[model samples]
Target chain A: MGDNLISVNNVSVNFDYQENFISKKQKIHAVNNINIKIKKGSFFGLVGESGSGKTTLGRAILGANKISSGNVIFHDDERDYELTNMNKQDLKEYRKKAQLIFQDPYAALSPRMTVRDIIAEPLEVMKITNSRQETDERVRDIAAKCRLNIEHLRRFPHAFSGGQRQRISIARALVSNPKFIVADESVAALDVSIQADILNLLKQLQTELNLTYLFISHDLSVVAHVCDVVAVMYLGHIVEMGPSRELFKNPKHSYTKALLSSIPSIDPEKRSEAIELKGEIPSALNPPPGCVFRTRCPNPGVDCKGGEITMGLTEVEPGHWVDQCCVL
Target chain B: MSHLLEVKNLDVKFDTDEGRITAVENISLTVDQGEVLGIVGESGSGKSVTAKSIMKLNPGNTSYNEDAEIILDNENVLQFTSKQDLKKIRGGKVSMIFQEPMASFAPAIKIGAQMVEQLLIHKNINKDEAKSISINMLKRVGIADAEKRFNQYAFELSGGMRQRAMIAMALSTMPKLLLADEPTTALDVTIQAQVINLIKDIIKEYQMGVIFITHDLGVIAQVADHVAVMYLGSVVEKGPVNEILKNPKHPYTKGLLQALPDINNLDAPLSPIPGNIPSPLDRPTGCVFRTRCPHHNPEGKDGKIEMKLIEVESGHWVDQCGIQCGQNG
Candidate 1:
């Protein structure tokens, strides 16, 4: 794992919540003991349904969410820093190095701000550049790379379409010259045609800048297309993780298999098998004691519910890790 | 195979503070009994507006062209004047389910009460019969403990359950036409699959004509018999689902298909349509898709290109420019 840029070791994020004044407080295990390593310059996909802890994990890595346990290590050619225990100054530096692109382009950009100002915001906030001229140059360079017209920079965000606004957001994310980016549902809100455009732009930028991306989304096909490595999360645990091709072609976990089968096929003649998971996802507040997915697992047995199951990754194939309990 | 609904030369416009915006223009489609017409388009493509116009569900500021005809069972629905007459057509002849199920339900009211109220308005059934029918519909939609869930409010149920309740309520009246506007878009993948299967089964059992609108071509391919590809308030192509998916004729259709990341072919490069869709207020002159079309003649020097729908194959119609552009390529 020497080439790995970020390594998450047994990381967990817990949130305390109360129903009302009368009810006792409860700890919601948003992301339970998870471990994964993302290689440098690779597009790693984090996929799950809502409440699967994918977003929480992404936030945890970006230092937006407090990690209750374990560590997230960020490595580069210059230095290495543990994100979970970074000092104030180090955290600020990490902020410059790692950035985020939001989901809704309509809401992500400030309506009143011109496209130039929106893209230049990170530089101004972080004081990464010395003068306005430098910031303007950086913004223009990234905007051009993101395929935004130079003249459109003077107009407000409201004048742009969804895909253009997304490009503006991408330009903003890229202006900081970050080494890693967490694109949380970045293309989910755009039209399918526009989604492909943004995805192609991201891929192109990744190659040009040598950047790593944590692409988080609920859409499996989109992830299967762009990502080099794919990790499937259920509840708070990663049930399956492997190279994109191997994972989609030959999934080991039952949950992963079920999710793949659930996608409505584009081919009219090829109907997916009836492998629907029953019941809604269990609440994170008081998740089932044992395997979090046991309730919805189609092939669960007594061992699945006997005791609390900690995630243990077993490499079924080279570089493909699946939960041990799922295999056993 | 009789026609259940026919929308001819429909044009919908909204009077906003800025100006009048045309949402659906010169659009025509027909649905036969037990047939599913899948309308696929992006967010602002007017698919929802087309579905809503069948029942005149738009706000008071909406205006329709005088020649616009929405005939339901051979009766023009747009000409309905009396509130009672429109009500008879709305939930009686046609029913709709929206993307957000929670917004569709009355929050303060119990699910059972809301469903019962809809039944009472549409049918001449007694309270006991309505209650039984509501519970049975809930059970049919695969909700567990239908009685308990029926008594609960919309907030009490989960997302999937609420959507199921919405479908149950929509289908309870047994309308001749069902307009589902991205009903499963908000659902999880597995849950969406379940709901899609449920809708397919219900369509079969009731023999209801359904106009399913969604942004997902995959979902349309699975359930729709015929499909209409919309762009900038116009249907660029209309054909059988299999034909459209397997061999798309329109450049936009081909671009859309090529853009999709196929799970089976992970290494294939996606070819996205270049340039953003023009804002509705700034629609182009000739073909709406010509702005981003790969086949557009950059140096043709023609003043304006007139595009018309031409049948490329039996049961498959594509815009003239789309075919011309493809041939040039």
Candidate 2:
């Protein structure tokens, strides 16, 4: 991958328990060992249901989470840093190079701050600008790029609709001029018609800024439409990874098949035989032996009852990889 | 043919800090026995308000116009004046399931206790009979270990299991109609698919009418026999599901179809609607969708909002447009 921007190699994030009296000290494996590469300027997608650890992986790459092991390397030209071991000054520099856009526009923005202040907060906190005049000029330039009316900056987020508030969020994320950005479900709360408008805006901005995005969402349809490369996650693991078109057309894993079948089709006459997996998702605290999917796999047999899981990522075809544990 | 439920010129209004606002206007739809009617619209489309109207579950500020008569079978639900009469019609004649299962259920109360209470209040049933019937209903909905789960609280169940418990409680009384308001929007896609199938099977077995409201058109295609597309506060179009999906005549409906992510056509880009919905207070005159309609072009510098509803085709309709179709005659 000549244009690889983000290199995540065997990174794992675990949340520590602080309670004093629990007999079995517990640690939540929010994100297990994961390795992937995001090409420069590509709209890469990370998709999974809640509690699947997709969000944690995105945060770990951004240096937002405490990584327990492995390293996340951000490469642009020859300037690559080991994110897990960065010092205070180096971490500050890394933070300026990468930023996050939260899922909830309403809660992410401050109610008391004006739009202008909200966009300028990141610059002020990072101490990137020396004077107020310089800060205002930078905010105005990014606001125009995001298609926000400069006059709207005088108002608060409560005065805007869901779509408008999202625009302000985009301006905040882009004002830092970061090389890599993580947009976490930025348009999931907006209407369907508005969702398209926001998506178009993001695509246009990506080209203008020469930015790489890690778009995280559970809506596979949206992912299929927007992302260049897609990764599927289940219970803190990526079960399948491939180009968007390839995976949608010929999904190799049974879990992928079930997820694809779940998307509602607009054509009433077209109905796929949906795979109904009985029983709830097992707790991550105590995962099952062998493959995590073996409990729900319809093809589970005597071969699936052991404690050993097939390791390594096997390439089924060009640019497509499925975990070895998948029976295919 | 007699319809299972009918709303005649229904209008619902809410008094807010700004002013009195109309949420649903002149809406009329009929659900035949054993048929599924889908009300499709995004937020602020008043899909849920219309469903709530059938059960008279709107807020105190909501006032139904005098012409509004929710006819269940033949009796007007609004005419049920006394508490006893309203009670007989509410859970006995029709039952409703909501979007959030946790919010709908009492967290402190045991699942079995709540079901038994509903049965006792509606019908002249004893505790022993209600408990047995509740357990049987839970089993029918495919809940394993019904006896053990019956004693558990709503918080003990998972998202999918909680929804099943809600369905069991709602259907135990065997109402003639079921009103589901975005029932599967909160669940995961796979879990959502299972719930959709469960509702479809139950409707078939009982032969009861259903009013399914959701923003997802894909889910509607799988379950609905008839589909009604709603804009701001009114029904833009209603027809057979296949006809509307294949050949959408209304501009708003066309935008919805184009906005959807086509799982079959993975290569095509999604063309989302360009603008947000106008607030009800600032609604454009004539056609409600003209502000967002790409075909509506202002001829001069005036650039005023277009306000005319035009009938473009038989059994299909659209607002006045700047685009010339050559079939205006």
Candidate 3:
């Protein structure tokens, strides 16, 4: 944990939703009891389908989402802060150390604002720099690092293409010099060629800035290339966690195996294996007891549904952790 | 055997507020019965525009060139006159599925009612026959509990189920050709695999020609028999799926293939094409891809370079002059 920049300890986020007009409320477990440690300068990936709560967990780390229980601790050489109980002033200061890169470049940036203003906004709101000149200089520095031309900064976002706009978004995220950044599906909206461009830029920046990333995405192939360690989440619980290569090559959990098999191979000769999961993701409001994934698991036994089974991490290999119950 | 659909020298332009912008240019491809032709391109590359041109589904501002010809079953669809003539060919002979399954359906209507309505309009059948056909089509597309799913609205179904319903509706008419525009793009990977398999199985069973448009090369590799790689409204490379994927001739095609992160080779570094795609309004002269093409040389002895499509092998074509220009002094 010494090298871990951010450590999440048993975090869970629950939301209350009205069942009907009848005054009945139900709890939606968006992010169940989870623990993850993002190492310094490492690209950690959190992957799942639409309702898997990856986004919520990412937001919780940034102090944007409410944490119903558990703690999220941010460690740095200068200072350490527990985000779950931070006051408003401390949270504001914590914001300068953490930021988010949004998913849709089209909707994320303001159409009327120029690229320079968009990037400078974080510095201005955070009061990191005093004078406008200081903010302008910082913006230019980060903009060049992100490969945005100085002349293009004066132009509005509409003038830039999807890839260029994403670069601007990256510049905006980096303006405050954040240590931990959550890039939530940042390249999901871009084309494949452009997606590579953004992905390479992110990897380069991670090393250059000595930054840590909690990259949340649903695309497995993209995650396989950019991330060092990967965690697969289902509903809200992480069923498998290991190095990217090891997990992708030999997945221990059945859910991880199904996900790896679902990726359409580029080689036309190789057809996907017959391991398709049946039915859609279950509703988080009424998730199945015991194992959250047991309803869709190909092999299920009486023990799988005995009671509310909490998964204890079992070290399958060095630095690899999987749900203990997953092993038949 | 005659091709089910043939598009020759097609060019589409739109009268925009700024000026006339060409959406698609000189694109040509053919889809034989039971064959799937993939049109792969990035956004604004005019892949969807080309698909829409088959059914003339573009807006009123769209203008097609005089020489453009879309021959469907030996009849030129561009020459379609009267609403009835277009109607008979549009949804009856050729049906389309869009990227957003939820938006494609009406919120107020039930899934079964919508399918039945489409059937009644296309086929001169009674209400009872239409209902039965609707239920059967839903079940054929792998929608479990078709009877129950039929009564539910589009909102009630999940993303995967909605896409299945959309497919079932599109195939209910028994069309000769199917135009699928990113039908599985909105689905999760697991669901996308399921939908892709369903589409392939249906194409085999019905023997219907398909024009599958997507930006995902992996999906194209799994489904398309022939691949047409488009860039900035032009087909940069066209060949059989194996030839295009394995032995790509064009520089743009090579860049695109290399850009994708291969699952088998996770450690390989991705080489994205440098520079952004030139906007439609600011399209470069000569080759449309020369602005960002790795094999583009602006300092030619004569002047700017000129590119032409050259047949590299049987049923394979690439831009020849672009490569020569980059290498020549």
> What Cα-based lDDT does every candidate model obtain?
0.90, 0.84, 0.89
On DockQ, the candidate that comes out on top is 3
Model 1 lDDT per residue over A245-291, tens place: 89999999989999999999999997757588999899998888767
Please identify model 2 stretches exceeding 4 Å from their true place: A17-22, A305-307, B297-329
What is the C-alpha lDDT profile of model 3 across A1-328, one tens digit per residue? 6899999999999999996789788899999889998898889999999999999999999989999999999998778899877898989989989999999999999998989899999999888999999999999999999999899999999988899999999999999999989999999999988999999999999889999999999999999999999999999999999999999988998888888888888998887674788888999999887788888887766788663566667889987888877865
Best-to-worst order by DockQ is: 3, 1, 2
Please tell me the TM-score of chain A for candidate 2. Answer: 0.95
The 10 consecutive residues of candidate 1 chain B with the worst lDDT sum are B298-307
Backbone clashes in model 2, listed as residue pairs: B285-B307, B286-B307
Stretches > 4 Å off in candidate 1 = A305-310, B297-307
> Candidate 2, B247: how far from true, in Å?
0.7
Between candidates 2 and 3, the one scoring higher on DockQ is 3
Local error of candidate 1 at residue A201 (angstroms) = 1.0
Quote model 2's TM-score.
0.94
Q: What is candidate 2's fraction of native contacts?
A: 0.73
Residue A253 deviation, candidate 3, in Å?
0.7
User: What is the per-residue lDDT of model 1 for residues B116-227, given as tens digits with 9 covering 90 to 100?
Assistant: 9999999999999999999999999999999999899999998899999999999999999999999999998999999999999999999999999998988998899999
lDDT score of residue B163 within candidate 2: 96
Candidate with more favorable, higher lDDT: 1 or 2: 1
